[model samples]
Target: MQTFACQCGATLFFGNRKCVACGCDAGWCDVCRRMTAVSSDGHCLGPGCGAAVAPCGNRLAYDVCNAFVPQSATGETIRCRSCQLTSVAPDAGDPQNVHRWRLLEAAKRRLLYDFQTVGYPDAQLTAAPPLTFRFLADTPEKHVITGHADGVITINLAEADPVHRETARQQFGEPQRTLIGHMRHETGHFIWMREIEGQREDQSASVFGDHANPAYGDAMKTYYDHGPAADWPARFISKYASSHPWEDFAESFAFYLDMRSVLDTLRCQAPQLVGAGAGDLPTMLKSFQEAGVALNEVNRSLGLTDLVPEVVPPAVVAKLQFVHDLFQRYVAAT
Candidate 1:
């Protein structure tokens, strides 16, 4: 997360909607990823209004978007690129839509934030379609599923219901489940498809397992029918990872990011982390391992699980090395 400011120079926080100092609304200008001040008036960001409407449609209609839709788009009623994720948004005017849409937007913004920090390319990298998401309302005629396709990720609006989500969590025997977790886990799948497949996929196969070794469709059927393997924890990060190779990759990817973020968070509290960033792959892993041990001891003192599951095993370490090499190469090229 990065700090932002309003036009008045007032400091703002991530996910803020309004500016406290100048009484202005805080909006994200997706074009530059900068924060803009929105006027309180109900006006469009169209050229006709000029800068007269301070809080532009980009902020008013959608909480925050990647970029401001230009005035020409208003006449066509086209969706903004960031908001395009939704294949379905409940009627904005509907009472239920207010609550659900806000929840969806907040979760989506967090996903975008993490994606930005990591520089993970979008589906455009594969000459594939751009991704989008939708909030689908359940009806007698159809059921909503939460999954990603070539260009869209559709989430059933009912998943926002606490009771429903809690029920699913319990049935799955997960310790924690939230909108953010779903977005993180699902985005892992998308990233695997867009950025980590092909050559990278072959490498993952050598470490994780053959990508096609498991019959996915039937593997899932067997999982639910027979339950998770008894030794799942020894080999998998979570029960879902036992489903298939693709799933194992997604779970691993999510865990990698989770571990990185949590370690970064702890570094803020412990100054020893200051020197951890200055290193190559082997050096960095040593730093991470040291930090993990110290952090795990602290967790045990407080009676919490080790924040990270385990050290990168010898087999998995090489795959993570590949990822590090890829990023370093990319950085140098850029």
Candidate 2:
């Protein structure tokens, strides 16, 4: 993410609610994609704010969102663009649920920011099969599965807890697992349904296998029962990706986002070292490999594991290129 500065000249991060230097309230401007100071009269001084602004209803009610809504927003309850996409939120009455929900929202906002940065179509709740979220608390009797259906994505609130998520990562033997990763992966499923399913089946199948395969379900079941093939690393980005064609596509999509995000962050911090704008797939992947090496070294110095544990083989690189081509097509169409 790009660095943000408060009106007071103090550095402000994405999740900052108030400027430490000026003690002024801060809210994120979706149009500007930055955190800006909120005036005493509740007007945001950000570039896109021509009218007064108010904290999103979710922020005012539960202190869970830092996004802003223009005062001119119509409706009985005004929500920020991000919050508007949430169809179901976890219970706020429980303190633990509230905290976990906040973590989920934070990750979700970052995911949406990346989507906007990459020029994806805006997710509107009013659209047919609108993009939406359901943050559910898994009960002892019924387990909640985090996945996407139609345009709606469901996340288990337990994933928001670091310890719980770490335990799951160990259980699944995944190299990387985080709330943001989950959001990115699930959003891939949504994008496939909305953008790729019927429009470019031939092109998608060329890289990700046939979506019409009759043994798709059985393949997924067997994958879960036994595990990925020994040569999975030669083609798939992750073990889970080897489960089925759909999963391979989603995994590659998520990896594409991850690489883009890291490269963007590097460009912002060291423009001299890395050029601006998305470069070609090979160039970007090469830069990511170099950066990952440096990042892993730093992590090792700090007594931590590798910053990025996944390896990108030639086959995975081809799949990522396909994902990039699809994104470019969507951007050009829009």
Best by TM-score: 2
State residue 44's C-alpha deviation in candidate 2, in Å: 1.8
lDDT tens digits, residue span 1-334, model 1: 4465666787766566667898766655454454455555523222233243223343556543323444453344444445656556777677776677778776777667655545554434335566667788778999988877664677888777789898998899875567876777776677667666765777767766776766778888989999888977666667887787777766666665554554444454564653444346566566667777877788889997565445465555564565455445545655
Per-residue lDDT tens digits for candidate 2, residues 35-139, read 788888877776556457778888989989998777764645577888888899998899999999999888888888888767777643246798899999998
Point out where model 2 deviates above 4 Å: 48-50, 73-76, 123-126
The global C-alpha lDDT for each of the candidates, from Candidate 1 onward, is 0.62, 0.84
Which model scores highest in lDDT? 2
Task: List the candidate 1 regions with Cα displacement exceeding 4 Å.
Answer: 6-10, 36-58, 62-80, 122-126, 196-198, 260-329
Question: Whole-model lDDT, candidate 2?
Answer: 0.84
- The lDDT, on a scale of 0 to 1, for candidate 1 is 0.62
What lDDT is reached at residue 199 by model 2? 83
